[model samples]
Target: MNCEKIKGKVSIRTVLESFNLFPVKENGKTGFYFALDREEKVPSLSVDYINNKAFDFGTGKNYDIISIVQQINKTSVSDALKYLEKFNFQPQEIDQKEEVRSNAKYEIIQVKEVKHPALVQYLKYRNVCDQIHFVKEIHYQINGKKFFGIGFLNDSGGYEIRNKYTKICLGKKDVTLLKSGMDCQREVKIFEGFFDFLTYRNIQRGANEVSDYLVLNSTAMLFKAEELMKKYNIISLFLDNDSNGRLITDKLFNQYNAVRDCASIYTGFNDLNEWFCSSGRYCDY
Candidate 1:
């Protein structure tokens, strides 16, 4: 696609999120993100969602979506467009409707085994196809339009649905707890998201099934797992390597006795799945 078409279809927020750069604070339609080039105590990049542009107060540099990608990837315009092509984009009108009714009602259409070719490919891409039993194919509707994603069910019957293009929660957001079927399970592994949990299972190759597993689905739901976490003698955290992950790890360390941060295993990567996919260990289970 041309630069204008890409700029029109993709949002500045989406590109930042793809690089794991999240806003430290948001005000109305504008978000204050950290400067992409350097580390700082406070955010100096102002991203305008409505206009899909970003301005860096630190360097006084302005960026549209394409330029943002170019800057972050340190690539030419052609390479940047190629990188942006991997993202799934919808029409501007649909994005506007989605933003306006983000909290609107949704209906679960169906839940079945992961069978669709697209979702299967997604699982393969994440290198978690061996753990397909842990997830399902979910079809849900929002604003009378139908969509499907690989669904990981939470304890509250809600689903953490994810596809190549979208990530959302259907029903009440909550945590997912998987017991080892042992009568006296005292160990639990905590993961920030289900994909990481699946990656762990895949890496272990079914050898580490003795302990219970808890997928937070989102770190924002950490509180929901606290009461359950109290019962475990060992709590191993497989959270991301981002600022939020470090903050949550520190919080849990202060609150619990045997909390272990396992992020060191995936040291330079953002999360476990990303590490697994890039570590040249994408072998079949």
Candidate 2:
């Protein structure tokens, strides 16, 4: 399983319990009793189940399951991740009510060519219509109500669903990989989301300017792209200017000497789509 899947699906309480370390309560809230620093009368490590996160009151350190695993075992990230895989914490199956609700909650009703005027305008609004023909219109239902969006399928068969009022993934999350018609292309281009890929296509205007494409959908999904990217002679990054973007770009930069950070081209914008919008119709994340 991928890091995001493990971090999200594995409960830290389960991890703590498996390690034979139990949490203690002081002020009526449940919390762990681990000592990250000097021991004290009150237990300092607290697990927040609502957020699926933890915090060390002593050191004022916040943690996710992966980080918590690293803390407990003093192990590296990859090792902690492997440690998590042994747990068999499959993503809990969508329970009965949820099965019904998920059926009702934007269940895909239909998918077809990008012919919706609203989605067409949404793309034109983002200035990415040059590649409009490649996208699809996804019609779904939630609570017996219907909705639609422009959809792009990623490598794992998940749809990156986006509309003016909403943005979400409809299935398993994964990166979108677009190959150069010829295999072993010397270079690849990276973007944080599919719109950025479309934005790049809109700017570059034709197939000649395009290289292989990797649309991460979420910056956190960068790890899934790392192995495939190593095959290229050059890698150009068009990630957002935000913290997540800078951090992942740094990780990619370290491993590949030939990787290039291309965000400088849209210096003040948060991302390629935002730059393309230029305060156009969609002001989004």
Candidate 3:
């Protein structure tokens, strides 16, 4: 494809997301991204999805979606086009309609406070037995197959279902918010997954710290939670030890001055839950 064709076929938002340079959704077709060509404390790259173009004030440069990718990766035009080819860009209206239909495939059968034996064992194996109160025993059917898993509710009324053999989401995907009862500075803890939240609780047992919790369910969902999160005076992140987590933490740190990364506590493990499980077996079975 040529320049205009390449730009029109690829969504800049998708391209940036593929690079893990997530941008906040501004409105229908416009979103603000961090400077792709320079270091910035704020988002200076404005992307227009409808127009398939972007302009970065940090670098005083205007570009189409292809040029943005080319700039960030320092790749040639042909290579950048090759990278953009990985994403299937579609009009937002059509994509949303199809997404709703696709999301309808999963049926949530029942959700209640955790009480299932197998789920209890699964929590135990993850070293989060005491966290049963926060999660639900979820029974769901997908693609004509019935399955059960531990479910953590997200802000958009979706459930992040997780079990030993399966992981999926039902309904709209969003972040999970857990508010600590006691009052404190507007400090909030951010976790990549609900299991990490449970692990943090297990590790910080008896502390009874009053802090808000935000679980993105997936690192890609961090941008979805950024608006409400900006109110916090301090942001503590307990993400996994993966590259995606590191990139997100770095982004949050740069954007929010008070952001603190607590990943050091579980430096050797993949995530907080892994570290918690490695500590000891607190199984009830």
Give all TM-scores, in the order shown. Answer: 0.65, 0.63, 0.64
RMSD of 2: 12.6
Candidate that would win on TM-score: 1
Model 1: per-residue Cα lDDT over 1-285, one tens digit each: 898887876556656755545576776489898787876667799999888899999999999987887777788999888766544322121221111112335799999999999999999999999999999999988768799999999887878788876666777666799998997767999998899999999889847467999998765456567668889899999999875578678878977889988999999998999999997766453
Candidate 2 per-residue lDDT, tens place, 1-285, comes to 788887665556545543434454423235656554454546688887556687887888888888877876789999888766544322232121211001113478999988888888888788787687768999986556688989999787768788775656676567899887886678899988888898887777645753788887764355566668878899999988865567567766767779899999888988888877884543232
Worst 10 residues of 1 by lDDT: 92-101
Give the winner by lDDT: 1 or 2.
1
Residue 125 CA displacement from its true place in model 2, Å: 1.1
RMSD list, candidates in order: 14.5, 12.6, 13.9
**Per-residue lDDT of 71 in model 2:** 76
Candidate 1 has a TM-score of: 0.65
Which residue pairs show collisions in model 2? 106-141
After superposing candidate 2 on the true structure, give the runs of residues whose Cα lies further than 4 Å from its correct spot: 1-106, 279-285
Q: Write the per-residue lDDT of candidate 3 for residues 79-157, one digit (tens) a residue.
A: 8776654343221212221111112356888888888888888888888888788888888875677889898888878
- Clashing pairs in model 3? none
Which stretches in model 3 have alpha-carbon errors above 4 Å?
Answer: 1-104, 182-185, 281-285
